[model samples]
Target: MWRYCSLLAQLVMHLDTFRVSRWLKRWRPPPWPALLLRVAVYSGLWWVITEGSGSGWLGLVLALLIALCAPLNVATWPQQLRWRRLPLFIGFMLKNSLFGALIVAQLALSRRCSANTHTRTYRFRLLKGHPQQLLMANLVNLTPGTLTLRLGCDTLSIHILHYQPQIEAQLMMLESHIAALYGLDHEPWEYEY
Candidate 1:
């Protein structure tokens, strides 16, 4: 019984050491600039929501809380984002959205509506659960006729109202733009139409 108790105590000591090391490894504090930026952005949003009301103390507390927690969840800091490429990405999305809208409008007026509707799953090149991947999914959903049905680890399932061979190319372009915005380098993958 004494030997068993000694072994159990040794195991508990090992677990405590592992837990301490793991906690230490993940305990990095947020950079000062990122924390300040988050505080400023959150405070501005609170101000807008409150319509310049004199609830300054509440806003400050809320802003601080959110700013402190933001770093824990974010994969990349806002400072690391490629701001210069954002305009070009926005333009690309807008152009594609316009074209998609035109195609949807054409399909709506035409007699054959469901003839070209299709659900295709494209293999994603971006890392799973990355912020860029989420943005890509949102942009795809924003475009007419292409709704993101499901976003998986390595695949994105989309419902296209008018299936075209070029749709995959468009998606690849959008993915590349988003990857650029995030300063990520990934090779485009081929998908069957």
Candidate 2:
């Protein structure tokens, strides 16, 4: 719970950190046009996830709620203009979420996806004590079959739902994904420890 709150607080902090009034002196974004673009993206997200889950009105209402949030989402619009991230921003969210869902699902359906198993344990040698390992470990726990038992200073021990050849590879891939997503790999040398 504390972690969740910290993440939310940081996100809200970052969103408000940029001031458009101060920013517009240096760069411009088509405010209404950009707002429309944001609305469209939110609509698309609403369509993708709730498309089949509920009635049309509920989806529309949900999408509108998401649209309502967009203005607050654009705090860095001017800085984005400075960086010219327009093309990248135009791209849709790729459907790679399936891999994560499938991994969680496999852990769920198998009896091993619980907090404990009859005789199950797995140990991981972290490349270093990256904080993301905790998230990775918690994800392992949440997927029904596993739980993170211990996070030693440099190692993680998790009770497995089940073990297989590709699991480590999957975790490694997830680590790289997380690192790239957050640009952790490019952090200044002073942060490496």
Candidate 3:
């Protein structure tokens, strides 16, 4: 029993170390481009919310985190990008945020959701264990009419209610947004419509 306890303690200690390392990377990022991105994110938030003094403290902290620590959960962060992609990525996120808000509003206004509505299920076959993908899955789950279920170590199964061709197209578009934002080096064929 003592042997087992000692092994457990060692494992827990290692996990703690890993978590601290990740936290430091974002919460206290190294100098240069990372700092620039962090500042940009915070300034954008300050503009969007438009509150003064202590009121924006939470937003400031969160913005700093989203800007700095995002790489921990987002695989694409380590990659560098051409400056040209910056505006395009922001536009993509803004659009996604708008769409997400609309989904929430519809769900709130409608007294009932059609239980019989058609849904399409997709299995992301051989999905790797990626913190970034996990973040995306969580975002997907937050939107109404969509759910990311059974997120596993190596796969994801997504469910969408109210199936339509446009939605599929939109998902494809999102793929491009992610690739661009993260500076993923995809071949031309992958990005082709």
| Inter-residue clash pairs, candidate 3 | none
How does each model score on lDDT? Answer: 0.77, 0.52, 0.60
Candidates by lDDT, descending order? 1, 3, 2
Residue clash pairs of candidate 1: none
Q: Candidate 1, TM-score vs. the true structure? A: 0.68
User: Considering TM-score, where higher is better, how would the candidates rank from best to worst?
Assistant: 1, 3, 2
Please tell me which predicted candidate would have the highest TM-score against the true structure: 1
List pairs with backbone clashes in candidate 2. Answer: 112-145, 112-161, 113-144, 113-145, 113-146, 114-145
Model 3 lDDT per residue over 80-187, tens place: 545688798677667776777787577667888553344454433222237546755775664445677666654456677656557655654555555555555354
lDDT of 1 at 119: 99
Residue-level lDDT of model 2, residues 120-185, one tens digit each, is: 334443334445566556555543334567776655666655555565565555455544443455
> What's the TM-score of every candidate structure?
0.68, 0.33, 0.47
lDDT of 1 by residue, 74-134 (tens): 4365465777888987898888789878877887788866657899987876544456677
CA deviation > 4 Å runs, candidate 1 = 1-28, 54-58, 70-79, 112-114, 126-129, 186-193
Stretches of candidate 3 above 4 Å error? 1-77, 81-84, 115-129, 142-144, 188-193
* Clash totals for all candidate models: 0, 6, 0
lDDT of 1 at 57: 81
